[model samples]
Target: MHPVSTPTVLVDEEDRIITVLAGRPLGDDWDEVHAEISTLLHDAGPKVGKPRKQERRGDYTSLSFGVSYGGGQRAPGNLVQGECSRTVIRDISQTKAVQRAAGFMNGCFAAYAPKLYEEYRSNLSQLFAEYPHLEQIFPNSVFPTATFNCGPRVVTLDHVDNTNVPFGFCAIFACGSYDPVRGGHLILFDLGLVIRFPPGSTILVPSGTLRHGSTSTQPNETRQSFTQYCPGGLLRWVAYGFQPVGSAKPALRRWFEEHHDERCKRAVGLFSKLSDLQQDRQAVFSLKGSV
Candidate 1:
């Protein structure tokens, strides 16, 4: 279940006006999440080495699963945690892939990671208020997400998540023993912000619109991050009665386009009220005693 929270605004000036939040402490499920992930670090999780990694632009290795729509000539479908095509960028949402990924996050690749999955969604749901559009857009739904990004000294280049829904919030949970102050910070290129993203802290980014990435850690240091995102086409699916945007009637399409300015204004208004900023930098290294 999601943790109870009364929404409030908090700011982190150290970054470019980014919101930091705290809810259920990360330690509550640290052992389970880490134990599940440790197995994939050596041999890759669901499949062989670098097959999943080949599609990505960075040095870190990862596995992702979600429901997505659109590309050059493709249609959408229900996706399990598997390989996505190279030209993908459409409706992405919380799909069955998340369930499998979640199961792994809480254990070895041998079983499902239910405990961590629930907490991830529960803690993440609190931030939904900032983007009120999700209620009408996704309606009764769970958050759409990305993958388990793991590697030694991970470094990703700056880029925008071009496929995510407009004004939708993406949650990123940082983990591993990399130094926050000296390295492993998230940088938003458009905002000129360098955020000291501590391990074990979760931060929300409108990844669909913002151009962001992270800095490098030392060769001997470990840096891992877990993140989830929603795609824009998902919003269209909701707005168009559970169908892809291309299927919209000509009249309705014109109507939506004519009012685009008003829609965008509403989105900006909602974003202005965001708060609950948190800074979680500490580590809970070993849970062997608890095990």
Candidate 2:
């Protein structure tokens, strides 16, 4: 299948962006960037955890970095949660390369979907401000959390990241060499899109809601991906006055309960419609020191 030749955005009936095919923001440097990232992942070797046991992800090693407030952790204290850097970040000496890959993905997000970028930046900034002790995986990155799908052959069974921010976007950067037409296609089950995802390209999607995975690559080919996302619990922790939802004051809880529907509408409105994308892009660029 021929890949999408141009940048594209898919939206729902309410004009919310379901996904954005951000093309190759690195242009001629795609080969170089992906190669460097691939080398870094390869060098990480056992630290990256090969041969994933998860049924959802066929056979690949993966690691995550950054702070998370959910997934059955104890209630937060005065401060938010601490960083969750895995062996890849702690044991490997490729911090710079990892940071570079993250920045590249973040930059692609800022360039192609500025509004979503700003939203992520704003919320993450606020989260960090309230809890200054938390360590960010990459200070330049807009996302609060990131995952490295280290794979000699990375492919996934259909699944949704239900823990991620339901209305927020997750940036997925495809890396490593593979035949995009024959394999490495991103399948969005809900949207009915089988996007031919090329190496070094990025896509932003509502992963918490979209059932997505990748097609298989050839036996000899290599495929890997890096993803940046924010968990819904983190956002809620921020919105709940820097406390867990269950720990919020009675009045504050009452107010949130009363305005639940209104808040949902507001959350959905964060997505930029295709018709307004030009204006949104211009508005984002017009800001002083945008991105």
* Number of backbone collisions per candidate: 16, 0
* Best model per lDDT: 2
lDDT of 1 by residue, 1-291 (tens): 322423222333523223433322433454344434333332242233454344444866665545455564243333444343211211222333223334332322101112222333343354343333333212222555456665654576887778776555566666556677889898888878887766555566667777889998876777766666655665565566555567779887888899999977755433322221111101111322210
TM of each candidate vs. truth: 0.63, 0.87
How far in Å is the alpha carbon of 264 misplaced in model 1? 0.9
The best candidate by TM-score is 2
- Regions of model 2 farther than 4 Å from truth: 1-5, 75-87, 90-97, 282-287
Candidate 2, residues 1-291: lDDT per residue as tens digits? 223347787878877567888776435555676778776665554553454466565666776667787767653222232233344555432466556667766776776567767777777788888777776767678777777777877897799999888887788988777988899999999878899898877888889988999999898888888888887787787788887778888999999999999988877776777778778878877864656
Question: Clash number for model 1?
Answer: 16
Candidate 1 to truth, TM: 0.63
